[model samples]
Target: MDDILKLVEEYIKEKDSKKTWVAGEDWVQYAGPYFTHEEYVRAVKTLLNGWLVLGAEANKFETKFPPLLGKELGLFVNSGSSANLLMLLALTSKRGRNLPKGTKVITPVAGFPTTINPIFQIGFEPVFVDIELDTLNLDLDAVEKACQEHPDAKVITFAHVLGNPPNMDRLMEIVKKYDLILLEDCCDALGSTYDGKKLGSFGEMASCSFYPAHHITTGEGGFVAVKDEQTERIVRSFREWGRGCYCIGKQNLLEKGSCGTRFNCWIPSLPDHVFDHKYVYEEIGYNMKPIELQASLGLVQMEKLEEIGLKRRENYRSLFKAFSKYPEFFHLHTAQPKSDPDWFAFPVTIKDGAPFKRSDICQFFESKMIQTRPYFAGNIMLQPAYEGLHDKDEVISKFPIAHKVTTDTFFLGTSPVINKEKTDYIEYILDCFVAAIRI
Candidate 1:
């Protein structure tokens, strides 16, 4: 073990060392893991311990992550997409609000597909809303109008776009006024806040990602943070293959599992017959649990969030300043009122009548080997997968902002990986693009 540890240390020192980028040869990714020797070691150590399943490491992450979101409980899952689907499942499942198939869910169209896909997958009708042009968040006025128009809508699900939140105060008022269950996709806004409250806390349930592109990385994982224990249990049942037993981690099964009656449980339908609780299936569920190795990586990643958040904010400001000089060409976003975003990117929109279109600047970045991304699935309603399924009139007349984003909006990375050297390089790339346009 000592010999192996010595070799591992050497490997981490060499491989996890600070990276250097060449202007032309290297690609400046829009997002990358801000990892270090510590995360590597923990991942290695987890494997060395032969603890491959969800045990102490997963339990630790579940305990540690929720408070950061101001959530009372959490369910660590396999991926951000799964986390989101579980949030939907927990709220709409038979043991939950249990709304029937074809229930109405109010959601935005200007978000990643996961946020919208689950609504359809779970058999809910989505009422599309346009995003605020600047912040790219769901327009609250429209959301209010949506609530008024669709009073029967039982749930409102939306993402915090590029870590930017809408006006939470007004949003909550709408949530209450309409009695809608709130499900926030905080996959991008891990460290953001509004009115001094964390972004994830404002909703009954929220999801966070730990993918390489997000604020933290656990190879591939995410979390579902719930408002209360009962909500957590429901999500857990859905997450852990719908098992009735709640025992997770190794210690819980040290005896008769966490419930102390693992083998003495009566079947729900056959109360006269008893069986092991661990094998008792409940609701229809999927296996979305994260492994102990990823959880180990997450434990270290959580410790670096404060640092990651600071760099993200710093890079966002720098990019904003760079773009400000070319105001005629770019339309920049303003963080919504009372929002202090741990921003995910520096979003830009090509203003109407601008000399260059979205593709022009995005292509310029690509040529320079600097990363850029078009806004997430722009006007998702127009995506081929959603063809003929949505209201064409809604896309044409009701969602003007959503319509523009599909053509004009794009974004750049604001992750901590954009160090001073990279930020300067990005600025140079932007200046070159603008200079060419001017000529």
Candidate 2:
């Protein structure tokens, strides 16, 4: 078996020797595929070991991840969206201090749907708010107005859109004043900082993604970080099929059962004590855990997060400088004061009356084999998924800012893999766009 594995590794290494750049590429991509041979080898070894489920490696990641973000507990899940689901479900658990039912959760309309979907799924009302164009994040003024209009709001769920941290100081003040829970969606802003603190650490709870496009790539994994013991317990319970037991994975070796007797358990007379802890259920939950293979990849990815963040920031700066010269054709998004963005993507908005439409420019990039993506779910409320989910008249016309961003905005890649060659090609394409607009 070892010899066979060695041969497979050798073949992979030989294949990787040939770097294939797509031809006729006039511009770069919105995200680059990031991976190293060593990481893949680690994943394969984990797979071969037969411990494919969450175990020691997952536990190590959970332990190390929170400290890096200045948090207490970290729970890994299958994806960032799953992490959000786990956090929301945990907040609603019967064994936990459930947030008020029908509680309104304030959120920006221009973000990923999972951020808001979990609220609705848990029977909480989501109050859509507008975002600031400068940071592409929830506008503090809009959030304040929403709170004023809906004093029943008990939670404020927002994202650091495109890696630009929101006005955390102002947002936290509102959270405290209104006695609201804050859940920061840091999936896109893993390494971002505001006022010297990490983006995900400021909120009561935070969520992060480890997809390839994010600052770090774990293929398909994510985590939720919580500040307090109670929240951590709740998070773990929800992630572990809502089990009441607080013990770690397969480590509850204590012979003294719940009733102080090895054979006598206390829950409605069960053969004097033959109860299996595996069958226990404390809260309504679902299976949302990731495999050990994913966690193995995450361990390797975490080691490079700092380097990846630096490259993303550098790429963002270069893109901004290149586009700053064409203010008439492009409006560049800016970071908030006291923010050092770990930008996920550099957003660009087409000014009103621009000679060409956004679709036209995007197609040009596509023709050149350059990839692009619209700002996440762009005005999520406007999407078909929300047609029957929300009150059309009340929300459809209210989020003007979100509407503007959804229509006029698009973002480019700042992935660490992008280099000078890619950036120069992108600039050249933009020059063509400028010339075409004048014609």
Model 2 poorest ten-residue lDDT run = 257-266
TM-score of 2: 0.93
Off by over 4 Å in 1: 16-18, 391-394
lDDT of 2 by residue, 97-136 (tens): 5776797889888888898889878888888888887778
Backbone collision tally, model 2: 1
Give the winner by TM-score. 1
**What lDDT does candidate 1 reach at residue 339?**
89
Local lDDT at 102 for model 2: 91
